[model samples]
Target: MKITSAVVSVVLLVSAQNSFGQFPAEEVSRFAIKDFTFESGQAFPTAVVAYATRGRLNAAKSNAVLLPSPYAADLHGYDAFIGPGRALDPQRHFLILTGMFANGQSSSPSNTPAPHGGPDFPRVTIRDNVRAAHELVTQQLGITKMTAVVGYSMGAQQAYQWAVSYPDMVESIAVICGNAKQYPFGVIRLEGSIAALKADSAWNNGRYTQPPVKGLRAFAIHYAAWSQSPVSWPRDMLDSMSNQQVDQFLRSLEAPALGMDANNVLSQAETWKRHNIGDSPGYNGDVEAALRAIKARVLLMPCRSDLYFPVADAEYEATFLQNGELAVIESSAGHAAGGGADSQAIRFIDGKLKGMLQ
Candidate 1:
């Protein structure tokens, strides 16, 4: 009997699921650091950093680009930009995607040993994540330099920190939809997110026996609104969702996060709260000095529609970078627009990055 069209559709769906299931096996690679010490003066006996790499490292070791993963995103989160013909252009650039410290794939509270597993994970800073990236490049990969440091959102925050912290190590950077400093609004949103998690009585001071579903659901609702622009809401995200589907949509977004320890979420939030390039020694809390200290080529892509990190933030910071240029992404994707959400954004960013790579 000939196969029915319905059967063919079912087969295709199963094929997609199988491919998704194999992602971890194909992409994950880890680097172990013995007796790691956080910038907070807290130390862990041993930690493993999760990462993924694409493209080929050149003979001179200069083709490598450090793409730091964003908040709550894994190493594979950058799949959208890494490929033969994508913006990252694996054909011409080696992409080293580093997972953020508390993001579970790395040495997160959820994955650490019993004693420091839940509420005991040390407070990690943006500087600490940059430190891990440095070690991953210098010690594990044996590279002294990188072609570019490309990042979005929290990853963009890392890109800024990397440029400021190690001026001589990077040749260029593309910081997208994020700022060099944690603005008051950024801190406020983070506080609200953490508060949502804590409001759940089951949080039990991060020692809960079960996940905090109620608080997490509330947190997800709050997060979903800020993730995209209100103007784009009717046409893009949640376009035709029924009242019931809206709840379903919110739950799916928060599901992955529900598996995470509340303390881990708070730890990363504190790091964000303290993010400021000026916090580095030379700047002494002066943001302008920190931006001025950057000597590498710079590409700043701020989204005009982004409420999280406003375009004005990048505009002001660009004036301070000696080699900086600002390219505003004119999409209504909000902060995500800079993450290459739409074709226009992808093209805009691809052009800028291609020029920088050249």
Candidate 2:
């Protein structure tokens, strides 16, 4: 799907400006912390983390729902399922938004230090990202415990990390569209995406001022294949996207004007690839053993047709979780729907969250 320049510009501008303008009903906020140190023993020369909150923290600060942003997604992704009468209603639970590392927003290469801003930012892993979130919830918000830490895709990986890293801090975890380990095939695909970016002459070894926009678009296209369901690309979605051919849908999702650095994407993808609860510091244990260590009740929400995180992945991971439940969002909407506000996902989230919090 070849997105016309006009539509690209519009989406980019809106996405750039508010990130959550489409969901005005929910309250959100943004913040930046200079030289944010990372768990990978490195620090971004400069970093910013965008966040949004709804409702209010109770006296004991236990009614909090920590939701991290998905890859290439902003906090708006959860709006439909988080309002009043919804699973994550701010009226009852304090919802906190955390931007994933290198999402081209909040502490990303696009907003990092001068000249080297784009891809030159330091590498940060899922573990590193969660630790920073822990700081925000504990030190900044003065919260000692949370009702839940929930997310989809990359955000889900962080949720898992939170459960393992601080089992005592989180009471429940809702993970949608993700798994415990990055399968070798998935790793290869991510590597190919970075390769597509680096192969472009514009990359200049991550030093290009205006890195290859075309290459970035191609990378986006490459990711689209992995992100969406194989057979569910809607005709309307295809029409809205500029790509003339169904094959080009992913390319249309790629926005070069966003100034998202290729190196940054590569680093973050690699960071996610390194995710593993068994690798926890001082935890020389089996994968199942580490997952079993998590005391938080778990909800594994997988899209029925997710191409990237297949249902089998979630099923295997669920078995390891100490107190876990498997909830499938039966939809042909694929992986994109996992990030979307689908009704089935909403119901699943609502039921699981309400039960866990209760």
Candidate 3:
């Protein structure tokens, strides 16, 4: 990946508090699907998906948006961009926040009953996740179609999968800092990171009920290196963060929470490693043909300095999709800027999301 100079001064502004009506989180009714086996072929009585929503559904229920959690990070990560006048304004559209399978809060190894609570939990794919989200909309919420689906990084991957798996169910998709398929380098690095955790004596063969904090911390440290641009990530930033008293914040990027089993990480990592639309086996045809098959309007947003999902990847997808456009944010924040809640990304999304609605 080529690195470019994208330095821009950031002037932080704290908006005055307003008594704007609040939109609190509400849980969606849950359901268990017995026959829904995972990609790993693990048999289970049910597959549980957890989700929270804000705002109201229109009479036509046509203004719904599904926002899936990014890898490891929960629904709270996108909180800053949602509100009355924000891109995901609850006043204008109903936003559903869905947790991914590996997230400990939902159906993951750590939370599964007894035998399934550790290394035994089934591995799930992006396809399986999208299907579950579809069920959430159709069965749980009674939403037939969504006006748009938007997210960043892993969440953006889910957004893409949603449009691909159920073209008729989505009108448009806004993907930021993500790719249709995990790059070869990304796959290798993720595998190595997972292996590093398992290799630690603290892991104890994935049987430790409390979790291997040391191993998790190591993994997080390794990931911190990959999560941003080397040129832009100054030592001062790391030093400043290290000075903080909160070890949890330091390790938040590194380790999973207590009782959050490592197997879940391995499972999700494997699914990501195999993440290729062409992996459907024998669907090995033209890449553009597969992209052109999508019926939804597409917006691809990439930060100019992003390390993981490069601008070229988003640009390539936009060229293939029937109604897609690339909107690159010119900032030095790298992959972090894409999800870091920067002004440029926010401004681009605000305009594009509204345009898609019109």
Clash totals for all candidate models: 0, 7, 1
In model 1, what are the clashing residue pairs, if there are any? none
Model 3 poorest 10 in a row by lDDT: 11-20
Stretches of candidate 2 exceeding 4 Å from the true structure: 1-36, 43-47, 114-116, 234-251, 255-259
Error of 3 at 227 (Å): 1.7
True-structure Cα RMSD, model 2: 4.8
Clashing pairs in 2: 1-243, 1-248, 1-249, 2-242, 2-243, 3-242, 48-107
Candidate 1 runs further than 4 Å off: 1-22, 235-256
Candidate 3's C-alpha runs over 4 A off are 1-29, 235-260, 280-282, 285-287
**Candidate 2 residue-wise lDDT, 120-150, digit = tens:** 6676778778877887788778988988988
Per-residue lDDT tens digits for candidate 3, residues 78-168, read 6657888777888988999877787655587767887777777777888788877788789888999898888777778888778777889
TM-score of 3: 0.84
Cα error, candidate 2, residue 248 (Å): 8.6
Better of 1 and 2 by TM-score: 1
Clashing pairs in 3: 220-254
User: Can you rank all candidates by lDDT, best first?
Assistant: 1, 2, 3
Span of ten consecutive residues with least summed lDDT in model 1: 12-21
